[model samples]
Target chain A: MDLTFTDAEDGFRAEARSWLEANVPAKPLPSGDTAEGFARHLDWERSLFEARWSVVSWPERYGGRDASLWEWLVFEEEYSRVGAPQRVTQNGIFLLAPTVFEFGTPEQQDRILPRMAAAEDLWCQGWSEPDAGSDLAGIKSRAVRDEAAGGWRVTGQKTWTTRGAFCTHLFGLFRTDPDAERHRGMSYLLIPLKAEGVTVRGVGRLDGDEGFAEVFFEDVFVPDADVLGGVNEGWGVAMATTSSERGLTLRSPGRFTAACDRLVDLCHRQGAVASDPRLRDDVAQAWMDAEAYRLFTLRDITDMVEGRSLGARSSLNKVWWSELDVRLHEAALELLGPLAELDGDAPAAIDGGAWMKGYQFSLSGPIYAGTNEIQRNVIAERLLGLPRK
Target chain B: MRFAFTDDQLLFRDTVRDLLDKECQPEHVRFAWVDGDGRLPQLWQSLGEMGVLGVQAPDAHGGLGLSELDLVLLLEETGRAGLPDPIVETAAVAVPLLAEVAPPELQAAWLPGLVGGGSLVTTQLGGPLVACADTADLVLAVRAEQVVAVPRAALRLERQPSVDGSRRLFRVDWQDDDAVVLAAGSVAADSRDRAHDRGAVATAAQLLGLGARMLDMTVDYVQERRQFGVPIGSFQAVKHHLADAMLQLEFARPVVYAAAWALATGDPDASRAASHAKAAASDAARFVGRQALQCHGAIGYTVEYDLHLYLKRAWALSATWGDAAFHRRRVAEFVLGPPDLPDRPSRSEEIHHG
Candidate 1:
């Protein structure tokens, strides 16, 4: 359909552009791989939240303007266009708040929604145990009833818990009935990171960044009120949560566009590799892919505004876009050449080896939420009416 | 602000779909394509009577005054039907240009016959290159800075077989005494470019139709063909490949339609949109054609099977005006900067013999 925005939407874009031009910090925020750097990024996020610019799609009652999806997309494009700091509270604003608003009780919403909006309580997902990843129904994390304590005791481990070390709250799934069917007996819960017996151990990636962690929940007590949706219905709630994560987070084409822009700028500035036709072709293809992805995302948003739910189609976008991101960063690494092997402490490192770091980070994209293999299966069976293999 | 077709447009699409289903069945297309002299006279006359040929032509030119969006809808349905006709060429390309550049007397003389299908006309026959010197009642020929209108009868026409059996190419010999040169200088150059741009959009529309037909044919074939006691379509690899094909088709559909919409609305960014759409459609057709043939195996390559015909059309249509690389380079230029031009001799002394 039509990809161009309306005049009113254009006005919104103009206003957003002006505001970002006036307010974006002169110094770029440090990339959020190290502890201190991530903390500083969180501070910048808090400042944005204070200015009520953190969640463009949330309701006005929840400290947002209740803007149209087009406006929200415009905000994202404008924000990323100006190289604003990455939203440190994305797990809170994009993931948790939407789920809580839909499934959380009134009191639960009151408790979590405002803090998430204000970035007062940072959040991280507690999915993906060491053994259970694509098959989340096979999770072994358990939360047994404690009659005397008037709550449940969660005792298990969660690996690949992104930003687990720094977050104040963890939203997760736990086995409420060990004897029930794998997907039938789980319960969604929110546990404070500082709860008694909770421990977070950082997992250093190849980039030597502690962005991921393994969290051990040792008899951590979570009140019944912390349960998201009905008990034993965590599978459904997790579906909703994971759908939002994959759809909203992975399909943000503006992110890739911004990355492509930076890569192009870097290529232009270096000038050494611009002579390679293969590299140039790769860059051009990446740019085209990003543009197509952005147009597709715009089409989806338009459908939503017209009251169409994309349902499983969102998985198609998620898989396609994540692979595109990998392609882009891989091209960046090739552009950087042998310098990509050098890391943070090297004297001649390129942009602190951000390209190498991005390459490593991109490796996790097709693995997290749902692997690309699983996404293909979804597209085949659900979208294409293929028989089960 | 609405991004969707209106009720009338929806009805128009439905009518076109219904007509194609009845008149342009695969069997009919295959029969006419194989037996006739590349022209389906009876079917063409019927369509003309049904007002399909004039769907987008101005009423003043003895045709219905419809938008380019309506024309796209008809093209998509024609694509779905695997229709073999030259309605797209005569209506979309020839008539529109004639209305724009022809003298008022010439417009009054030829447009009515062209729209009514009383006078059959086809585009210039060349290998992915445009030369409107043959089959056209009046050739819109551009030489250097001048655009000339030459009578087709005055030019010698030599037919050449092409990969796309549905269309025939011709070599034209134009005598220096039989041309009516129109505008010259920069105006001619700009008009020619604009005409090429419009031709690109129309060709992309045709490819879109071919792509959709190929997709449907492949899907149907896979659904019926059995291997090891199962429909081959049930296989994961086959299903995934077809799904990917569908994705390309659907994505390209919107881009094509968007360009048509821009052209219809006379948007300032029409050329850019048209190029984007053409590039996307060309890639989609090539991709879908390859996969469709692959899915059909040996039979798809056989002459008896109709899949090869559609694939041939797809290949030929994609290369027309410009291929994917050309359009992509145009996009790159737009994004980068204007390209350097080569100097050429001026056409100031060129004469109009007519």
Candidate 2:
């Protein structure tokens, strides 16, 4: 059980560290939820694409270095440490890109991935609907065949569409055969947001930002060629995306460890909390949790590389990181005493009140990808073989 | 960078598991309370014959010379089986300490015997309490900055019966100029810290196994035990309880494994890693144990069932080397700052959920 990196991995880390140090934005980018912020973040992603730093783990043909999992981890470590702008195209680069590489036809991969990698086009998820959030199989979104137009007309509404207002494309589930059973007869489709009869209205999030949108598809035509993983098997295809969403592609342990470092630095800044014995251990545990996640991810990567099937355990990873993210941010607030309540722009706000913004952001972790409660149910029924209700 | 066990290590774990499965069943564990000395002597002997007792001893001592990582699964299996013996204290704690610090003649006299099952060895670590001191042939202990091997005959034991019927703890009162000093100054201090770390990591691993056992048992119970005209496992509350337990155990495992590896490799972060393992596993075990029993309802409370074994073992093991709070304090010292301030439970809980 070797934990240290090899020379090659060390060199990769060094190269990443150097490149990030040199080119990363000197100040934090604006929240990508805003139009101006989104554009700037997109430009940051384009620069990363030029340097092949955007998707280091992907194969070179997909505009990546084709790096090993270890190197990929190293890259993530550096990426988070530099406080780089959040990946504005994560919906495309992480969730849909993996699906495209795995299940997309060569034409789809050829047309979609490079542009996605370069952030020329942004993507958003279309799985959740007005009535179907946790119970996704209950989605009533329908797409009927248009044989003459050689496609399907999709009609439905998808809510909680993250960054949907700015995204140009979406990948979502559509009920292809109305007569089919639950979780069946569904097809995954890639549709342009600007398609005829489609409208996206931005939804304000907890931080009063439009990080998400409500996308309505009214007889929007999606080409048959855009169907993923074949027809009536969108459930299986979406499962792949969910796995990536909950696992390495979406959330990296490095992000949490970096938060831990910042939390530690925050505690160091607040000399007042030093006398509180309880907070001291709480502070220590924050770091321990971060390190634990790091080691856990390495173990996961090792198991994956060794041909071990990554299974329902991703639910466990999701719960661990989501809770850690929330608790870590909370710990920062607790250590900050009264200052934690300040707005980020407040004159007396600590760390620019990033912790306050982060706390609200962290709550979204438990709610997104899949709720922690749902993940717990999955762990119980699927992993533990408990009887389902 | 492999994180999984080697095939040989896995085989060792399987062998220990097979042994525990056969010999450490409830019938045998019950014997500790019914007829025996609260020690599974036969399983202890068999572990010795299999060289499991010497897994961490050096090769020169007629042992396996394995590191903590290799022995971690074995210890975990022992915990899973609710093995009532000083297996961890003998192999992971005492033997390693003596092998690393004992004088040559002292080592020759006791190391092989300790490893080969001819004798038992235990330690008084972390606290003044000496577990299994009465049953041990030799005891590794510390006085000031010196580490000494005190013979069992030199010490008087006051028995401390625990809620966990499987374990027998004792306070060792000793007077011993005849004790053999193994190392002094920084070496002794190092050996002392190493022993404590090993004990903490081993205890953490055992707690993990105990938590896992409880979780698996609770899952089985919830599946068969019906309420409201359906299996209770179908209930969201029951499922969530068990699921929460599973989450703690699952996440704590990597920390335990990583700590074992850190101590084994003598990494710079070994101290913090050991504390991390102890803190995480302790919290997980306590959480899982309580939740498991709660899910089992009244049946889990009765001693007629085997649930008490893992639950009691969890309680016993969690406070063995260091409890969650204690280890967390240690972790705080290393990463946060001084941990010597008086603990305020109310404020602690507030900060805990804060």
Colliding pairs, model 1: none
**Every model's DockQ:** 0.29, 0.67
| Root-mean-square deviation per candidate | 4.0, 3.2
For residues A277-377, write the lDDT of model 1, one tens digit per residue.
46665676667667767766766776777898877777777776787888988888888888878886699987777778778878888888788777777
Cα lDDT of model 2 by residue, A334-358, tens digit: 9988888999779999977889899
- Residue B341 in candidate 2, Cα distance off native in Å: 6.3
Q: Which ten residues in a row have the lowest lDDT in candidate 1 chain B?
A: B345-354
**Deviating ranges (above 4 Å) for candidate 1:** A1-3, A146-151, A178-181, A248-250, A270-280, A330-353, B46-52, B64-66, B124-136, B338-354
As a whole number from 0 to 100, the lDDT of residue A24 in candidate 2 is 95
* Model 2 misplacement above 4 A: B339-354
- Residue pairs of candidate 2 with colliding backbone atoms: none
